[model samples]
Target: MNHIILGNSLTDWLIALAVAVAVAAGLDAVKAILLRRIRSLTAQRASRARGVAVAALSSTRLVVLAILGLYAGASLLALPERGQLFAGRAAMAALLVQCAIWGDHGVKSWLASPRAQQAEDPGRATSSAAIGFLVRVLLWAVVALMILDNLGVNITTLVASLGIGGIAVALAVQSILGDLFASLSIVLDKPFVIGDFIIVDNALGTVEHIGLKTTRVRSLGGEQIVFSNAALLKSRIHNLRRMEARRVVFKLAVNHDTPEPVLRALPGLVEAIVSEQPQVRFDRAHFNGMTAPAFSYEVVYFVESADYRVFMDVQQEIYLRIVSMLAEQGVRLALPAQTIHLEGRPAVLPVPLPQDERVAA
Candidate 1:
């Protein structure tokens, strides 16, 4: 080996390099052993602190050791001022990169932590993922800015410029951003979730997907209806799936000529029919007074389920039974009719002649 190289003796350089390598290896080995012990001891009692420490330490161990070793080895040789400065900057950049990696890993682990999972409200997994992604992006952006600053770039102006540009970009995509935020609100607030039957404005459908900018719904007609999340939030949303019971109001009309006793008994009869049906609660039945051609009755009830089909079935059964009972009782259902009355007839009538008689006839 050459005795002298780059103004340092080869032996001395080799010793310094060996010392740096030994120190790095020793540090790494110690970290590994300590981490292993800690993990073993806390395996059943994993806490937030332990999780954070593990995530931060796990990703950048080798890179950090390499950076330390490189700096130590470089210090042993006689290098120009510019070269030393460049080496320092490079080390700083590597450190920043390692920090970014550590932050990313830590964030991901935190997001996937049992505590986070437990803390999340039902149906908020997508919101958590989105939050994690945004945090990571911000973390890397900070890391990049630090790297550029270490490399002698003026970061104050750059930060200002970035802030201004971000505002402009935000304004340009305000609608899309609004929808994205609305989607996050939907996930977190949980007005509705996947498989929920919802009615928005005139559209009725089941929620299928909640995306960043839009919610996709499968309508009753078997077609997809995509609505902007912002607009959906703005509109009134009826989440039928969350209903424990459904209120039903129906009207029945009987012929005006029907006996008053039957009209008085109509409420009791309807209530009995409603009570007999399974999963139904009779609310009230009333003689709603007389219409032009019929005696009107109003019936109110509750179906003890959120299912539309079940409600329809119960209603149909009630209708059929009511018709059958009324028929058995010899009562008549009303039909719409008009009754016109004239107090007097026209005093003079001019009869028209046949078309063949002409004007003179």
Candidate 2:
């Protein structure tokens, strides 16, 4: 065995191993300091150093573990110096890149999780999650390309081939690609979110699932409908989820013979019903011109909630109260009727019919 000894008995190989370990430790410390400075500068934090230190400590364990893996791989190649240099360097590069990327994603996800955030706004939370995922994907892609180039691969030639292939693939799957792109746009642009009720073309439903090719919706008619993302993106979309209020309009007609006092007080009575309602907003009430034997009035109000049941309840309450109020005011509802007068025609017609029958007898 060719073994190195310490002091008088120590040899060259032990010293080299010690030197490599020292170099790894120093590099790790320096990397931690550099990352801390970079994060501080970008985040504009001075007192956040402790938090950075804590994050680095946790991340360092993962990093150190990766370095250890590289060193072990390198040491095994040490039998041949020239071959070891190339093999060891490549392995070290791969390990460092993988670990760094892993740490970045790990730290960011830990921070953005609801468990980490003290207070969260839903809009900000969703946006951050989406952006974070995209950023992580891009970072890894860049790292992968860099590693390939380091391995002496012809990146330019590869890119060219990929581009040509991509064109053909794109042409073949143009419709599918369009839908995928549209889904990406939906994620980024955020016109609507999950659970939103929307109307697109003849389809009206709640958003159940969003996918690359198609978006699934559950219609109010107890049916599920699937739409191509490209088609849904092209259609005129109406989101009822964002509706502020619901409006109701109806006409009421009172007898023209009703008292003038009741006619004048109708607006105030209608307003009272609207104002007292739990979630109704009074818009207007007008005494329109007489229609034949009745006087017409148009009433309009808004329901505060988009809920159908709530709107119906408010409307029913108002209707019952309005009917009672009209009764109290002695104003009756109009009904269709006709009056006819018969004069002097019955006697002469009956005698002529009877005379014909008597002659036959």
Candidate that would win on TM-score: 1
Q: Report the number of clashing residue pairs per model.
A: 0, 3
> How accurate locally, in lDDT, is each candidate?
0.85, 0.73
Candidate 1 residues 135-173, lDDT tens each? 898999889999999999999999999999999999999
Regions of candidate 1 where Cα sits further than 4 Å from its true position: 27-31, 38-58, 61-64, 76-78, 113-122, 184-190, 276-279, 336-361
TM-score of each: 0.78, 0.69
Task: Give the best candidate by lDDT.
Answer: 1
- Candidate 2 yields a Cα-based lDDT of 0.73
Weakest lDDT window of 10 consecutive positions for candidate 2: 1-10
lDDT of 1 at 354: 82
